[model samples]
Target: MTKGERAGADVAERAATGRAARDRLPIDGHGVFRPPADRADPVQIVFDQEADRLPDLLALRHRRMRASPLAFYRGAAAVMAADLAGQPDSGLRTQLCGDAHLFNFGLFASPERRLVFDLNDFDETCPGPFEWDLKRLLASVALAGRANGFGRRVRAGILSGAAQRYRTAMIRFAGEGELDVWYARADVDDLVTRLAKSRRRRVTRVGDKARARTTLQAYRKLTTVIDGRRRIVADPPLVVPVADLLPTVDRIALEDRIRTMLTGYRSTLAEDRRHLFDAFRFVDMARKVVGVGSVGTRCWIILLTARDDTDPLLLQVKEAGVSVLAGPDPVPDPDGEGHRVVAGQRLMQATGDIFLGWQRVPQLDGRTRDFYVRQLRDWKGSVAIDELTPRGLRTYAELCAWTLARAHARAGDRIAIAGYLGRRGRFDTALTEFAESYADQSERDHAAFRAATKS
Candidate 1:
């Protein structure tokens, strides 16, 4: 067998014997990421990140964050990354979502037109301990539950339920060959059918809403035909036309630059995909405000029309910066951030955006910024946590667990991780406790952030 095939064979043998001679880490130890008495100030970390983003949008980002502590935590992936530096790990690494909060899990269309549920965001994605993503996900559950005014016991139960499901799912995935695990997909319909009547109804509604978000709907809503020219409608802060953001002279030049970048982006696609992509003619481009954490970054929507004017496609190209997990101890990532985002995304997601590609654009100031491009809102949808009851949260948490385990298994040594997790409840219980305590810490940090920003 080839070396890689040999490695897989070795791992399969190890799993069959309960990871004989593998490093056996204690389950309880996953819970211990004790912040030094002098942990980094959360407010300062927020400002540090804000410094590199668009200036005017910082106010909007801060406003969104102040709405709730979970909102704050959603935008504070860097702060958590710094804190996770102190945590013990299984020594097994995977391409991390870096910000694997509950809100980041969503349903999106696969290339085959099937809707699949998986991790959605990848701006800060990079290689890190598998547990770091798990920890971040569990903590988000606690914070989100608290935001909905769920009781402490209810919130803790959500974390416990989620962790247990992750352990169970990992064990299941471990039993399969690596290639078999890689081919697995978490189809949204399969998920919906398995739920109770109440959740099934809710998920069905979500599917309906997602189905309605077609390219035609987007074009009709966001574009207008003026004379013979189709143009993106100016929508102020939310969806500003490129002309609104720059003078006429600069607008012409920037559009030219973007067109050139698109050429580079097209080259990044596979040969077969590039032939398909070439069929779409560029129509217009606009700056778009997107997401809680991604608020202040440079995000643009590119509209393309197929041979017929009625057929439309929307592509979103957003700036990619250094991953939050590119800390002192994590795997090094000094190359292209755009490639970093795309590689991690492809590694973790069962299926990915067909148009996904990366490019670096030169700025007016003689610098270049990395960016990754993908289809915009391809039947994309997320659960409304505030609308969910405590029981609904429990069900959703389990779904997140199943999805995350599949993602982690795709990138890391599934046999070793599953063996480290074992077929037990000890790790699950410890993680739930850790999540609850971390939620309390998040609230206090949120208060400090509010005060610091106010001052």
Candidate 2:
């Protein structure tokens, strides 16, 4: 075997034997592999109590980080620390999608037009405990399943499958060569076929077909242009007009800045596609409100058109502050926060849009904020959580774990992780317990949020 391959085998053997080199991973003040103590306080309560003032709550969260990027990092760290305080852990750290809740999983079109399912959000992504991501994911599974009327046993079964898949994948990864682990990926078509073979029920076939249709529909909606507007237009509260949301001066300034940012952003693209950037010019800009977790964050969609009015591209410039899991008063890295989002996304996704870039813009309040830009609606879509049946949700959860494992494997020593997990089912069992416990915690937090709002 080649040297690298041999080393991989050695690592795998050590991991499989449960006696690999034990290195002390990073830990917070709470003696856990999480964010620092101050940042981990029950902000959920604050978030819950101020539901009526969601903008205010979001603004409050933003303001804490606005003092400096480092401050935002610290704030995020605290939130994560708090969230992870009582949770069980795997003790394996990898670059994680820090907020891996069930809703954060989704289907997006790959560069090849194939609908691939993966973790769709990365606002809180960073190197940390694998368990952190798994915990958030499991909790979300339970919360969403309960919300959708699934019984506890069904939810537990789903969680068990998810945990098992992650552990099994890790163990398999341990035995593979470094290159193999790095290159491992789920083929969406193959995945569908595998699912079809697992259970031969009419419901399974119908659900699979329905999911495929929904994905195609979302792709069409994302790419469709409305009149001269190249964006998904708002239908009031659900999709508010960006034009109605911004101040007149800020709106004008944003249009000017977007044009400038796009020019700079284009330079980051490959040489062959650089010509495409010149054909498009920014025509309009507005804040297009989006997402449950990102409700009040500053997210704007910029419209661009070629010489003719019909050929258009929609770009989303989203604010990328410090992660809510990073803790309060984080030290600012001079490169800017937008770079963080771009870097993290590039690391996690198999392929990303050509227009991805970062910009630092001075806000109306005199503070400069970092933001990452990308095509706003280029075949982006998600499964409707409320619409999923119990079995569908379970299948979907396994898909998320498979994708997450692929992403994590890309950035870390997959063999070491795989070895740590071992061939036995210990890790899966631990995660199932962790999931159940964390799900209870999420419900408690959700209730706390509701009660905080009520009081």
Candidate 3:
């Protein structure tokens, strides 16, 4: 047979796979959501995750989650995972940003030093049904729109439009060459050029802010000169220096241990990046409380300097745990949790930080934990969800949806997934309904969590 015939046969097989998925669970069936009779309590699920977290910081994590419903949702990936497990999916597996909420998509500097918008957080990243990520993203849009004081109708439109964007983008990706699809990225400059004059300033301002949030900027804000030595400032329960954290332990010994762990982490980077890392001398380290969900986890800001205190590099080493999306009989992953996050980030992102790496290190409690490391802040910024207008929310959702589809296409069978969605609005309609329903459920869960925390 000719090459043309072989290509046609391959397309036919892939399309058939997608069509067959509808039989397992019809497209419209996705709209349905009824909490199982024996569903686990959402609060309990979150509390269970705290088992391995820092005891003192658990209060801070709870406080952050209690700030608002969206805050609770940000920290409740485990809860959503349990709820999603009780539902049906398309069976099209992909590398999922397991917590693909709207807030998780943001702008960060690429290796080429250009601002690119993509999924920013990967703490829960793992291989799973592609629809799980889609559902999470849609639900987040609905929730965020509601938070922004948009009416139900407006939220519904945004959710459906976002889902449709995902479908259309996937279909487009299905028609592209492998390399073309892999190379596609959401460059911020191109996004700004496509936006209206009225909206361009807001996005441009966001980009500018991200660019200003460099390592040097962080050094000026988070460090102070103490007796001719630059050291991380102490901000109890928020940012505590290593010396303060281990008052009884010898400061030099602790610094040596941190350097040792980072040495192991450096081995994970490319030879060129390793050379780049070697130039900086470790000056100080601090335990920092960061993000709504990541508060209790072991997160450290390692301050390194080159020439003078002004020339600094801030590396954030965050703890890595088992993904909420991991199944009972999971796919064999050779690397530990830290590597899992690093691998997933590499798979989903067009370009990543040169300093991104992973290592398993012994903790202060004498237990070893997995950790992933990257710059603390390198041109990172996210839209203010609470400040967006209805139209802005819809546009942002579309951008996020398109980015997600591209990420999924890179890892999953795009032809089959696109074939499943077809050229109809059935999946879009169903997903919107699911988002509305899930948003209500999340509110109720947040209330329950708040009551539990208070008790």
Candidate 4:
């Protein structure tokens, strides 16, 4: 870091901030609801993305989307991205969790084993408009409320209340200095302490569930001994051993490919992370179907045994691809998709997995792919939004909004975004209006998705 480099960095940040300020000038508070007449068919976008995915698992992805509009929304980031592009944007780039839906926020263990809440999924993460992430989140609130059988009034209330929190939090962050904003976090302990008794109980229950989701529990649930060798159990389409899912040739080459990938992954880690990762010996791996949207994508769980057989570690290696947020205004990712994901996750999360890193490796057929690796089990758990009552939903919704604001504050131009979102309800109202309209589109998309899967 030379003086010239520091000056250049500061100037670049000011330019980005200037862009964000300009974005607000063109788009009125009510201008966010522009659903273009030529908005592409959501179903077609899903199908196009399916081209890079495992063909056999497409049915599972479709089935998941067919379950409900919220489920459909969860897997429809591409659709939303397309739709959002037609809407007014702030043009302020930030590290986006491209699919920042209701379900994407979750409880995960920090390195110290403390429960912390933040945006948990990042397969489609990239630098993009701050408004894009907020729109996705706001729409999810409406869709989740709909799935819970909430009326339009209640759904409207949820969106408004959540937007208020987001606005207020951003205002609060704007007052803080640079380092203060960067160090902010959503610690579960602090959250629980602020809640009423009933709400506290609910938070504790989710926290307990998160704590129970350890690597030991994952081992018991996903593995068994076969011929005196520990191996992942064959559970078709859900948690199948690699050999059971892939062709003989692909299965035969799996070990070597994984080894090489891990080697490259190790090289990407910081010295301490690499040192810790090097201690674990690769024991086995399995292709696992995970999440509603991620079903068709290549995701693997690799087992590693520490000093003794009882000491085990599980690492998840997920394929990274072009982000849904990337389009004509695509932000650059000079380091590659894997690096983009890793960087985005670190920027957005207050604390992240110690094993977080990336690798670019070619598969057996020789197609180079980017994969980001992290501990598969970090005591992660998500609430069932379908089961939340209106009151619970309201409480959960505010927390999510607050968390999203904190993430944006840390990664984007906090002062500019905070200023754009002043102390007012106009921006909030506009976003809620957009969310209601989009919820209807999601239902239509779900119906089409159901028909396509069955056909």
Query: How do these models rank on lDDT, best leading?
Result: 3, 1, 4, 2
CA displacement after TM-score superposition, residue 375 of candidate 4 (Å) = 1.0
Stretches off by above 4 angstroms in model 2 are 1-41, 44-81, 85-91, 197-250
lDDT of 1 by residue, 175-275 (tens): 88778899998898887878889778999999888878877888889999878888899987889999788899988898888888889999989999999
lDDT: worst 10-residue window of model 2: 25-34
Per-prediction TM-score, please?
0.94, 0.78, 0.96, 0.93
Could you tell me the lDDT of residue 256 within candidate 2? 74
TM-score of model number 3: 0.96
Best by TM-score: 3
Tens-place lDDT per residue, model 3, 320-352, is: 888988854556456668999999999998889
User: What is the per-residue lDDT of model 4 for residues 27-134, given as tens digits with 9 covering 90 to 100?
Assistant: 345433545678787888989988989888888888888888888899888888888766656766667888888889999988887899999998888767777777
Q: 180, model 4: CA deviation in Å?
A: 1.5
**Total clashes, candidate 1?**
0
| Predictions in order: lDDT | 0.84, 0.61, 0.89, 0.82
Best by lDDT: 3
Sort the predicted structures by TM-score, highest score first: 3, 1, 4, 2
lDDT score of residue 152 within candidate 1: 87
**Roughly what TM-score does model 2 have, to 2 decimal places?**
0.78
